[model samples]
Target: MKKAIGQILSGNMLSKALGLLREILMAKFFGTGDINGAYRIAQTGTLVPINFMTSDSLNSAFIPLYKKYLAEDEQRAAVFKYCMFLFFSVVSILIFSILYFQSEYWVKLMAPGISESAREMSVSLLKVMAVCCPFYLCSGLVNYISMAHGDYKPMSMRASAQNVGMVLGVVAAFYSGNYLYLAWGFTGSYVFFSFWVVFRAFKGEILNFPIRLETKEVKLVMSNFWITLRPLLILPLILQGNITLERALASLISIDVVSALDYARFITDTVVFILSVPIAFAGLSEWASQTPEQVREKIIKIYYWLALLVINMSFFIFLSARDIVIFLFMRGEFNEQSVMATTHIIQGMSIGLWAQVVGYIFIKALSAHLNNRKVLVVMVFSLLSNAIVNVLTYKIWGAFGLGIGNAIYGIVMFLVSAWYLKIARSLYPVIIQISAGIVIYFCVYRFIGGYFNESTSAMLRLLVNGMVFFLFAFLWAMLFPFYRQGVIKVMTRKRLR
Candidate 1:
């Protein structure tokens, strides 16, 4: 799991590094305007559903089954790979056609509250964005398939390629003054990636596609896929649908609301997802063969370690959100209002970042158990509560209410997954530790922040405050047995080397 995480982390780091650059370029070029809002919708609107079908929950279903099929019979596994690839390609291409032809209606469904002109822009962008659905679907398959085969490096580098596409679009749109390139550049990334991923998968000998297989062999693969995929299919519907609605909800306020909310999410979501996602992916692969009890125990241990780092991270983001926003995005059309808009949302969302780290693992644990039904039940509850919470609060807080809703959703997701897994009881101690850590970190941050004067630069204050706070957190965290041991082992290893 550690090795897998390292592989995932390295790729994610570069990818996210580029992602930051991409967001910076976007902020400078477009800011919180209708053009940016529509572009965001065009990109997010198309990709969200595509992600639902092909990413997260789908990968959970695919990787374990791929491993099982390969172990039991390599030939059958290859057949399954080809079968799934063919199946998704056909399905996704059909989806692309429908979305391409119906982008006008599609944009309306995605963000009904946008102005008529924004809607028109979204339609145009969605048409171009629609072209990448099949590529994303197919590329996701090869990436996961490659991961199953112990090839993680190419997968990590993939983000750079994809971001390179978006970055190009940003520069082109800035120089050429044609926003159409935004959609075009974004779509081109996935098209490039589909070819890149498949080639890597083939070169790694992960699977030899287009190989001869009997009708019976295809049936066997499909049968297993059906069994594996059916249980987890609705996950995307519940989870992804909730996200779409949330974005739509943002759109309802204003195009600027939609854009600001999108901007806010990019920062908060990256912080959470980048940290948790690799661990979840790697943990799923490891826990796939473990018993329920063993998996539960590992969940507790992972939570124990991961919670501290993430909680500190969340609080840091919360404390310095305004500064961070200003540092990252306070230029060009992104002005003080943009800073305030995104800063509030980032702070609101930070309240729940720690929850997602654990929640992701819990979901993966359930998926590893093939207990997708339970996963569905928890998500449904979380979605309902998330909706109700957002409804009641959006009036008060505007789109930033959605950020609070996000925190609630993640906390609910984590708690519910824990309850369903029968590990809720064991997690009590871990939760208490995390709570205490947050309280202490906040107090310390407040104390330390008092020393930094208004004369300091936002970036400089953020840097100094963060480093000092973490140094204190590190010293305080050493009082705990687990953390102390972890630190000692690290120091010992360094001395030996």
Candidate 2:
């Protein structure tokens, strides 16, 4: 699992580096206005349901069951994959057809404040992009299959391809003054990446696309899928709802508001992609296969490690929010207002980074056990609380308030899951260690930040400050016996494996 995580994290790093470039190009070409805002709404709106069907719904249910089947009989597992592919493919086709024909309705609903001209443009672009949904569904299944086998390289490579395609599309849009190029670019990326994934699966002998409706494995898979569907669907609905609500609220403020939120989220997601997502992906199967005692032990170790990583990242980002935003986005149409807007939002978002990390750890642990009912209850409570907080605070804090509300949701989720799972006591020690580390780092940052000249390049200043901070953090972690022992244990365990 550690090896898989290392590979996935490396790929994630490359993908995020490219993703940053993609966002930079977007800001340069489209600016943080109606054009970009409309595109953002249309893009997010179109993908939300598809994500629900693929990642949140299908993959969540499919992976554990598939792992169980694979353990029993390879042939039976192959048959199950075939049935799932057929089922998902047909559903994806239907979804795409409906979305393509109803593109205008979704666009209008998702971005009501956009100009008529921009809305029409977004609808057209959305329809074109809708062509890629079935392909995404297919590719997503392939990626999930690879994940079940502990190979995340394919998924990471596909994301890199998508980022590369978007960068090319943004360049085309820049030269041609045609935003449609961006949609086509993304479609091309999905189509190509899907083909590549299938080719890789074939080489690995993991491609089993034949339909075998008569097989008992088919009946078994279908039954399990339906059983897993209900509780699994809650997470996606809440996640999609959060995005829609955030965008809706931002639109009420201004198009720039939506763009600002998007920019800030991109920064926070970079941290999540690196530190949290890889572990969740790699550990799902591992946890599922573990004994109850082993799962408890694993969760404790994993949670503290994630807490350390996320806290360091959160503090670094919070301290360097302005420099990061200016260095990455203060160009072309992304002006002073855009920089200030994005910087504030990033700081707000950073406050929740630790909570997000902890929340994800709890989510994966629960899912591993297929304890979906308890997880569902926790998710529902978190979503309701989050919505109320967002409504009450958005007026005063704007996008930053949205971040705070989300952070609060993450905290609630982690605490609730910990208490329910009877793991709350295990967190007390790590909490103290993390708190002390944070205070020490903050003081050092205050003294260190004063030394950098204001006239220096933002990127240079950030790079230098990041180096200094990491050095201090490294020393702090190494000096602590608990952290030192944890690091050695991971290294020793990996070597033994």
Which candidate comes out best when scored by TM-score? 1
What is the per-residue lDDT of model 2 for residues 274-340, given as tens digits with 9 covering 90 to 100? 8877787787878887876787788787787777777787888888899998888888899887887
For 1-497, candidate 1 gives per-residue lDDT tens digits of 88888988888888888888988988888988888999988887787768877766678778888899888988888888888877887889888887799888878888988899989988998998898898888888888888888777666777778888989998998899999999988899999988988777777777676467899889878887788778667767877777778878888876767778877888876876578877787877788889988988888877878877888788888888888888888888887777877877788788887887778789888988678778778777777778888878887998678788888888898889989989888777766775687687677657765657878889898888888778877777887888899889989999999
Write out the backbone clash pairs for model 1: none
Give one clash count per candidate, in the order shown.
Answer: 0, 0
Distance from true location, Cα of 24 in model 1, Å: 0.6
Can you give the TM-score per candidate against the true fold?
A: 0.94, 0.91
Kindly report which residue pairs in candidate 2 clash with one another.
none
Reference-based TM-score, model 1: 0.94
Residue 179's lDDT in candidate 1: 92
